[model samples]
Target: MTAAAAATADGAAAAARARTAGGGAGPAGAAAAAAASADDDPFLAVAVPPLPRQLSAKVQHAIISADSQLSERLSEQLGLPRPLILELMRFGAVHYCPVMPKAGPNTPMTPEQLAAASAARAGAMARWGPAPKLQVPRRAMEDAPATAGGYARVHLQPKRFPAAHTTDWRRRVLHQGPDCVVVDKPPGVQVSPTVDNVLESVPACTAAALGLPLDSLAGLHRLDAGTSGVVVLGRGGLAFARWWCGLLEARSGGGGSGGGGSSKSGGKSGGGSESGGGSESGGGSESGGRSGGRGPKAGNEAATARAAEAARAVEAAAEAAAATGGAPLRKVYRAATLSPPPLGRMVHHALVGTRRPGEPAHTLMLAVPVEGSAYCELEVVQVKPIALTGAAAEEFGPSAFESDIRLVTGRTHQIRAQLAASGCIVIGDLLYEAVSARAAHEAAAGERAAHEAAASGRGGGGGGADAAASSAAAGDGGGGTAGGEAGAAAAAAASAEAATAAAEAKCGFAVGSAATAWSRAAQADPLRAIGLQAHRLAVYDPERRLGDGAPAAADLGPGWVEFEAGVPWWRA
Candidate 1:
């Protein structure tokens, strides 16, 4: 064959091999062509099975009431995600009337029957002066037991409380007297029994501690289950009444007069009122000898009479003060908070209840910074009760601040609600900004990581990096001990371990302990876990005289008393 013909054949053969290797003309080519065809025509592709969307009980009810489109719109308006709304419907969180055509014999009308009856009554409303009587539909769970009315009813499960044995109430006594006892109450214990709880109340625990009957003891003031603080309880009804009267008088700005008078009289009248008359007589005798004696004697009589009248007036005032229960009482508290309020700002915010215009609530705060804490920036605030007045409620924002709170009004959840309205939610307060602190913690953790990273390394960016490195080096150098930085870390770990041990001991729970029986209790009740720092540091009654020339123990009055609890170990 000619050379040109051979070259042409070789080129054609090379082209054929290249086409086969590149998957241009074989099984590979066919597969590629098929994939291309599937891509171009979606129907040719293998179908991806759609996921089954689960609907909750609420979502199911919503869907029953409206179409999917309407449900979606409702969810949007309610600020709920579509998936959550559907899930709620599927779970039957929402209630609806079960499908029924007629009322059963000897039973009330079913929800459907009631609806029909209502419609009929409405149609005949023009003929009658009053609308026809119709049964209202009873709400029920999707999977509830059927009742006599031929409709199901959902009985809500009652909440369970932690067993009394789970809490250790010993060693919480702050002070005890014949009239009253002050207890350093721990968190999670109720001040009084409610419908859902009968045990683990402050009154019950105090009565048990004092070996008195529950009926014999009465609480003077209430502290929330979440708040750890000093609780005062009277030993009997008389004691309670006296203490309550004193507290009311103090709140009403009618204390201190009796105490002040008694103090002044005791200080000045040591030798009796006759000493002043004698002094006047002696001075007149020196001025005019025996002639002036009778004149001075008559003057002394008049002066003595005036003095006696003044003494009688003071005595009457004192008696009136005691009778009216004008015993001065003051409450001091220590709070740990997130925001650092001005050193001495008196917050006068009005708090309203469920059905009335709010009363004025006043709190005097003194903020102090907490040093060297990695958990969160905290301030130690000293709170003193000021005054509560009948005032209109004030508006406030929803931000959170952590502070030690003291209640002047001693109203229900006064500190919690007031502080929340003022935009300072206590840490771990679920009713307020529970999620806020957690979010802040996460953000702080990230910042701390960055800070540590910056501190450990040498200069890389600006003066800030150099300064951080220098500071870290200084800290390392300051550790001067054998382990240096390692020693500091070890110390920190040991401190943390000690704190954990103390917490475990205080809480009466240990790792893997049988406390799990009551573990579900706190989880069932969110209020049990909220962190409210309201420690009653001290309480004072002005009518209770102390120090030199004060009355003996046997001479003390019913409302005259004082009690104090030390700072919490965490703060100490």
Candidate 2:
């Protein structure tokens, strides 16, 4: 038979096999038959072209040279799949065709045809388009600063801070950690200079101190200028948010102890002593057996040694806490007030009726009256009663006194408002009623002097000055608190009381004489996720000499109010 007849016969046989393997009749079967008929080479028909190397050396070089955007641009230009491009970059391969699984064996391509198709596809995609202008990734890796173990210590110079500031603020190590920092901000210094009149605003101070870039440090918390306290500084953005949330949650009893958002700030900086001996057992079976075997004296001696060691450890821990301001940091303030005894009592009582929502019902307060009303020690402030009359009486009752109160709560108009609300307004407080009395006194005196001087013009000029002086004196009670804003006193007291009350209320308590029930809840519940409540805080005005014997306790009238640090038990 001729070559054409031979080819036709071969194709027909392959078609029959293809039809049988591809199930009866349809597009798949027809295509398979066509494929089978296409290959009928007499000899040397098995060998096919090698796989095409599409992405040429030039193409690869172009990709590498194009800025960082080359990969992205190339993918878009070629319409090639990302996986394929990634595969090429990773494996240095141009094309990938999945190997077909063999079932009953009606394959579309023989080994020879398979080889040819793979080569042709690879070559087509290679040199596809003008390589896209590579776009660079936005995030650039920065050089690590002077850091170790998530802490970066960078020195800041004073010049970098705000201008027109008194005193040279020195440069120091801005201790930056992953979460927070312990910074030593100078007294009367603003943290962020641009933020007008901020006390100990360390943000600008931090940047200047470290000689780093601006806006590098953010003040996590604030400290009053006169009252120094530690402030937390967050490092990166993510860590900042986490640490902030962690603090809020832990203090509020939602988040577990991430670091230390304890209920009380002044308490010892660690967990309270697990009291009641933990377990009450005097001995166990093992102890009994050991005592019997080793003799009683030997067991007793061992126990004694253990107890001694434990005692030593406790002593050591106490010493460490004292040294580092670690555990149980306590403060006692010397204050002065006018109201005598029971009336003088400045109790930050739980709100009168239903607690104001969102307020910590547990109100903590401490009021220590200074002695002599003139001289005292331990940071005592002198307070004098400013007499009131006329309209002032209608405004702020008839009595009010003024003095600076060292407050813990930074609440709104806490001290002044609380004091006034307690029926003892701070002297010279315009918000209350003292201002009107001073005005009345000045007006009366001015009229009397004017009538006397107008008849003769003698001492007439001096009357105006006298009136001004009296008004100024009345506006500012003699020897009153000068430094710090006046509103702060009232704001501080109210805030401290509010914060404490809110805290107490959160533990479910209402103000009443039922002390035992509230006490039990405090001891047992402990504000849910927090720890034990330490003893109520007390403010004591230490005695100072006035050329007499030991200075008598300042007349604070009656019992000074007490406060407590609501500590939380940490669950490790």
Name the top TM-score candidate: 1
The list of candidate 1 runs beyond 4 A from truth reads 1-163, 252-327, 354-412, 421-423, 434-524, 529-531, 537-561, 566-572
Instruction: Give me the candidate number with maximum lDDT.
Output: 1
Give TM per candidate.
Answer: 0.35, 0.23
Candidate 2 residue lDDT tens string, 182-255: 35443333322211111124544454555643334544333222112233344434323232332222222331
Question: How badly does each model clash, as a count of residue pairs?
Answer: 30, 57
Q: For candidate 1, lDDT tens digit of each residue in 1-572?
A: 24643454344334423432334554565355344432233211111110011111121211122223422443544554433323222212223232222334654656785676445444333333342222322222112222211211111111222423344556777666666566776665555443222224565666666776533444444444555665655555332333343333443233111110000111110001111000000000010001101122455886565445444434444454556454234344443334544344334322222221221111111123233211111222444322211210011123323345333333233344345444454444443342222223334445444444443442333335444444454355432433343344344445545654553343333323233321222233443434354443332334442222222322234434444455442332
TM-score of predicted model 1? 0.35
Identify the runs in model 2 with alpha carbons over 4 angstroms from their true place: 1-164, 171-179, 184-200, 223-229, 252-410, 413-572
Error of 1 at 408 (Å): 4.8
